[model samples]
Target: PPPPPPPPPPPPPPPPICQDVGYKVYRLVPKPSVQDKGGDTLELELPSPRSSILDTLTNMLCATCKPLDTPIECLIEDALYKADGEIYVLGRISEDDLIPFRSHKINLDGWADLHLQDFLNLGFHDKNKKDNLIVVY
Candidate 1:
């Protein structure tokens, strides 16, 4: 019998390097704490606090080895309903807020919002576990 023909060579791998440019939405979940409303009747803190998440994300991006755009947005507790412990932090916002944060274009929407409780449910582990700013990114 004759030998079979050789198979075709495999395709070359993709480019060695490429710029990393993209947008990411993160949900900031706070760490656990003993402080709670004296009773169920008491009001609970909003899911993802706007100010807190904004601060944390700003710091994280700044500290990142590969720094990205600036002037990011913070959409905390946008949802109308209550979602257990998982908050949803959306990168998309309304057109109004989008203008000012043009520097950080990553923030898709001008009106973005997030829920703190919902964020925690995403399983964001923190060392201190004290109202952690959970970033879903």
Candidate 2:
């Protein structure tokens, strides 16, 4: 029999010209547990929400992939929350937690968690705060 025909070429990427390519908006709605207990109108303003963390986390944590552009978030054996110009860390994170996290055994959710504004208050924004207790560069 004769050979099959070749497949079509892949589509080109969208142009770089200005266009309303639409946007993705995220809202920090309370979880089911919180919503069930929410009696009144509770408002919450979340801080620096990234478009995606799974891919970045998977690459950085599992593989040796190191992204330079993303902000640095790590944990150290300390009690204070460090939010310098480069990194973010919650309560102390010693070798115990760091080892597992580095090995992809656990995730960063409970022990290390804070809204965007809170983190920025310690890092860059430095605005809309009272005393600036968080400490930023």
Candidate 3:
């Protein structure tokens, strides 16, 4: 019997879309606390209160990694409803009152009114290895 024919050559790799530009991305994370337990409230200390915006997204996997498709304004207990913790939602005015560090977002979907817990719920835990917001506690 005769031998079989050889297989075709492999295809070339896809062209590059663009160069990998290094962007200074920032993710809002709850200030690392050695201990947090004073009722059902979680306090996040942001470096700069006025410079950053906080908003909530629906089914978003990561807060810092991507832009929100639809962001809803936070009423009094928006974070409480969206959060997966025992945090008692307070009027954002209170949270904003005591932040001790600067936090920033990419400003997609009107980043003007994002909430603290909302940002955290989106997966800014830094455990997510995306190039977006990488926060390590």
Output the number of the lDDT-best candidate.
1
**Candidate 2 minimal-lDDT segment of 10 residues:** 102-111
**Error at 30, model 2, angstroms:** 16
The order of the candidates by TM-score, greatest first, is: 1, 2, 3
What tens digits encode model 2's per-residue C-alpha lDDT throughout 5-115? 899999999887854456543456433332233676665444333234443243333222233344444344332211223233333344343333221212223223434
State TM-scores per candidate: 0.21, 0.21, 0.20
Clash number for each model: 26, 4, 15
Please identify which of the two predictions, 2 or 3, would achieve the higher lDDT against the true structure. Answer: 3
* Model 1 root mean square deviation, Cα atoms: 15.5
Which segments of model 1 are wrong by more than 4 Å? 1-31, 41-58, 62-64, 67-95, 99-137
Tens digits of lDDT, candidate 1, 1-137: 98998999999998877555675566666854445566755554434334544454443443333244444332434321112222223453334533332222121111244444433343343445543343333
